[model samples]
Target chain A: MNTELKLQALLDGALDAREIREIEAILAQDIQSAALMQELKWMKAAVAGNEAEVKLPETREFYWSKIERGIAAEAKQAAAAPAERAWWLRFIYPATGLAAMVAVMFVVSGGRTTDGADTESVPEDVNAISFRSEAEAMSVVYVADENGTFNPVGQETKNEPEADK
Target chain B: MPQPPDFTTTLDVQLVAFSQAGDMIAFEELVARHRDKIYARAFSMMRNEEDAIDLSQEAWVKAWQRLKQFQGDSSFATWMTRIVINLCLDQLRRQKRTRAESIEQLDEELGGVERQMPVVASNPTEGLERAELRKRIDKAMTQLSYEHRTVLILHEFEEMEYKQIAKVMNCSIGTVMSRLFYARRRLASLLQSLKKEQQS
Candidate 1:
């Protein structure tokens, strides 16, 4: 191969020592060869240039901790998963049951009716009344308490009428 | 006196065996052993130290997760290096997907701006010390595109075969050869130009 092709291959280590030496001799025979050789040598060095020292980054403990924890988790998973993991599931069920019970009690006990339904807080059995919607299709007829009154929306009675008196 | 065993060699076999058997500590030791080399390889490819470090760590996590597949066909370090290279390539491919590079348009290699480099008739490294030479070369290397820079690092520093570089780069061996060729040429021109500037 010509010097141009040989130069690249030589730097590539594709050309053996004998080929390199022969090229060196040929170049020694010509001045222009010397310029070409210089370019080739510099090119080789610049590419094959000694590498900068590679510094290993200092490791963070947090990174190691992640690996440690992940492995520990796997270890725990292997050793006794049903015991530890089941606790979380088991706790969820009972806690959910307690919350559901509280919700049910809140609905059934009718604790402290705040919507002015309490003005007539007379326990339903004592002075039972059913109020009907004006549509009557939804009868909410507050069966009139024998006391003769029920305020469904909780408006106050200002005064008794003469007829009632 | 009995010769001491090569600790790294011994440790590598032991760790690989332990890790294959599902020992997490053994895998961690392997990570610590090879992290720097893998990190450097990724950094060289990506040219972004932070991303390189992250990807290298991700590669380790993956390697540990997939330790079962390692058949021990190669040296552990070589196997690990392969993993890191694959991760870096995946990251590059992801970036390539988001980039606007048209393969058809980019195939044409321009002679490029370095071709017009001013004359540098003198030897740049003639009298400079090795440290200075390395510094200048590193600066020149930084000027190369990621594609070109990766080929040069793999070829020169890693001493990887062209076929191996092609695999790492996900390109044909011909592409590897061409990139190395052009990269070396541009670097030669750049360095000599830098040298000329230093001298004058």
Candidate 2:
């Protein structure tokens, strides 16, 4: 580095005493060198003065409040996202849809024989059974007893059956 | 364990840690400590109060967002200052696109008085009152082109080394030296004339 730069570095605490001496020897060489050193000294002072006198602007509490709000807003935006995503809806909606599907399937395939024996095996999720008599198709329907027997449904002829018996 | 750090030291570390954890209050403390320097840098670059303030504020937000990457390799203020400088440079680049007038064009015409600076004047700022010195420096500083004033501010006021300044200004070391030399020459001449005006 140039001697003047070395001197500047020395003044700024970026150089050691050995470097300072080397620069000091260079400065002792000529009158021009001495004049330049003096100028440097004064310039350093002027720079220090300028730095000290630089007035920091007035940032009000309100300004800080705005920054705080902006940060908070960013944080809120980043945090609130996954919560509003309806993550449970991602699970529950599909689940409820599956349940509705099972129910419709049960209604579609839950037909039993007249003596209440299941004529067709159904899926594993089938829980309870009900039947509807159709005029165009099977005229009657039955409820299945666990003994693999069927009893005709809508057959409660309380009066006519007793009289016949 | 080492002795407990004092309040400010403890606070600085805590602020960094908290801000890294996305704490606003801690980030605000960091901002409050360095906003003046940040604003001063932006203002020196943009040369407008409102734009400087806005850009500086945006820089702080960015710093908060990017706090995780800070490895504490340097002082926290240094890291933060770099953030603000980048923001200012990005702003300058954007403005260049819309205005269609590069800094070179401006320097060729209007900012010449800075490029062709006079020699150092005699004791320009030595004996001046503090307020007068500030005003004179402000005026002279405004006279410098964006390039020169930016180098001067980073070097003189911020006490940045040539290499650090190159990184901040995104320029080469040779350019940094040239700009610093011309800027100081102009500043010396300006200070001298301001002093003369006062004497008269």
Which prediction has the highest DockQ against the true structure? 1
Off by over 4 Å in 1: A1-6, A15-38, A46-49, A66-165, B1-10, B100-122
Displacement of residue A51 (Cα, Å) in model 2 is: 2.6
**Candidate 2 local lDDT, A1-165, one digit each (tens):** 555445545555666778878777877886655654565455556765474233346655655775667777888998998897778869998999999998887788765225553244333444334443233223334456777566666763232334556
lDDT tens digits, residue span B1-200, model 1: 97633345556888888879876666777777877788778877787877877777777766776788888898888788888878887887788778886553264244233334443456666777888888888888887777788778888887788788988787887677667666766777778788779769
All candidates: TM-score of chain A? 0.28, 0.40
| CAPRI quality band, candidate 1 | incorrect
Can you give the lDDT of residue A25 in candidate 2? Answer: 82
Q: How big is the positional error of residue B35 in model 2, measured in Å on the Cα after superposition? A: 3.2
Interface RMSD, candidates in the order listed? 3.5, 3.5
Q: Against the true structure, candidate 2 has what lDDT? A: 0.68
Worst 10 residues of 1 chain A by lDDT: A132-141
The sequence of per-residue lDDT tens digits that candidate 1 reaches over residues A1-165 is: 446546556656777889989877876787765665566567666556487656546564555565556656665666796787787998899999999999998889786344523232245555455443333223332435557685453542334446866
**Clash pairs (backbone) in predicted model 2:** A115-A150, A115-A151, A116-A150
Provide the clashing-pair count of each candidate structure: 11, 3
Q: Worst ten-residue run, lDDT, model 2 chain A?
A: A131-140
* lDDT of each candidate versus the true structure: 0.69, 0.68
